[model samples]
Target: MTDRPDPFAAPFGSLFGDSMTQAELVDGTYSYSGSAQPMENFSLHPATHVLHYGSACFEGLKAHRQSNGTLALFRLDDHVERMRQSIGLLRMPVPDAALIRSLIIDAVEANADFTPDPPGSLYVRPTFIGTAPNIGAAAVPSDMGLLYVICSPVGDYFAGGIRPLTIYVETKVPRTTPQFGMVKSGANYVMALGPTLDAKRDHGADQVLFATADDITETGASNFFLIDDDRIITRQLDESFLHGVTRDSVITIAGDLGYSVEERPLSPSELADWAETGEVFLSGTAAVVAPVGTVIVEDSARTVRDGEPGPNTLRVRDALTTLLTGDADDPHGWRTTVSG
Candidate 1:
């Protein structure tokens, strides 16, 4: 542990744990070792299905080293269910929920020595890829696949800790295909790369908010939100974007704090109007709750209410943090403790 680089100082997701768990699917059946194994590179054929056909997806969640000297996985079951949904959508045979849960637990517990302190956590990545070695089967789902869970000791997804972000509104380019938007696939991420890089180079933005003809969807990697003194508003769930776990947690905690949660269609005009008074933020597994201070719509850049982290935003953030670190009671049963 002393020889490893500090996760806080290093780039996020660069420092990995020593152990991992994996399973293989062949001929419509799955096989796992029922234990953790040493982390290593995988050998794949040049014509692997995922390489040419894009038959891959993944889920991101965290295992926090709690205030009480224990480690717990946040929203573990929900992530498992979402990963299964993603696999099913990829036209592959989905692994049972129990198998996925056990794999995560085994991987986390095996790497418990690598767990960092609060404000830093063990970022767990459960990935699935097709390995059928068939470049000709673009329309056919792979009969062979690999499912694995690995851990990375991470600090912050965005650098400089938690601060307000600058978002660029993209009204012309859609993030991904509408029907497949809900899947957590790398293809969806690659679709946003061109616009995101352009925004960074031209507008100096932190992330690109895809509106696609004034219909607000989400940022590249997180869910969007509009927060104020009384209510919280966001785009209702459909097939247009990823439904975030932290987004759900925020809505639940905000409701517990008496803020009205409204899930509906949000437009760029409505966002510009809300930025005049209300607060805005992004939520995700990697980014717990990120405050937005500025938004660039076309040629105009609008600041969100003095361009600082608002009180309500901080309040919700604090509550979620407390619950995550085990300082508060688990009323919703969101945390699952893993054995050290």
Candidate 2:
């Protein structure tokens, strides 16, 4: 039997699996060296471009251990494509998609025994950082880059499991730039951290709903969705928030379940008005589908359906969980089984 780390005792983002995949971008070419020995620290100069200018991009996805004892990756190809797009948008050298995919599969397979069962997954983080050391200047198209994939066995992201989360809506601060919002880069989250922390500290909220100039964008790390009795409404995908893969999956599954999914601009006023009748939730790879109990907007806290996880939210989450674990027929073909 393979020795696995005690996930329950491991600190967040600290305990990684036995090995990781490393690749280097040199002279505009990517050289993948397959899986490598686990290293706790990275060697980079003090003037690394990523440290100063934030030329970094990343992708987050999971490999789940199904009931049938098979390990499957949730939408691996889509994540790879998204990572490629993020690199392109950041003007960083892009890694080969096929190579990256292979690296991910290999890393997961290498650490397959470490993946926890249901309610836990192998959290895969594929990161690209600009390694060029030039403090006075920004990397001109990011000449040097490092691409590495790390896996961690994580349980539920939310401490209380699938309970409804309280979110605070920020009408002043924007989540990210219009053009770069869709990209998975560290800068975007950094921009949102202050507001989120304030929300948690001041309002006792779980997350922040980042509204750009009064227009609702997204929650801190996930896409926001509102479910009415008849239809589902979410903010339209633009340049400000991430196009979450889990959001896409939820929308598709909701559509298949006969719910009309509407993508449009959602204002804070509209959200306040809609909160009376609609159910709100945040969707992401980490949180999956986390229902919103209340949204603290400014001084007033608006409750969504008595501040509880609504029936619709629970139903969708159940459906998604079933689909993800291979209990349901996967029509979208998102699952990729991994071999140990």
lDDT of model 1 at position 151:
98
**Tens-digit per-residue lDDT, 1-340, candidate 1:** 7998999999999999999999999998889999999999999999999999999999999999899899999999999999999999998998999999999999999999898898999999999999998889999999899999999999999999988999999999999999889999999999999999999999989999999978998999999999999999988989779989998999999999999999998988888989999999999988899999998987589999999999888999999999999999999999999987
Q: In model 2, what are the clashing residue pairs, if there are any?
A: 178-239
Model-by-model lDDT, in order?
Answer: 0.94, 0.85
lDDT of each residue in 103-202, candidate 2, tens digit only:
7898888877778777788899988998888887663755788888889888788876888788888888787777888889898888888888888899
Which of the numbered candidates is closest to the native, going by highest TM-score?
A: 1
lDDT of 1: 0.94
Could you give me the TM-score of model 2 versus the true structure?
Answer: 0.95
| Candidate 2 weakest lDDT stretch, 10 residues | 1-10
Off by over 4 Å in 2: 1-5, 8-12
Q: lDDT at 242 for candidate 2?
A: 89
Best by lDDT: 1
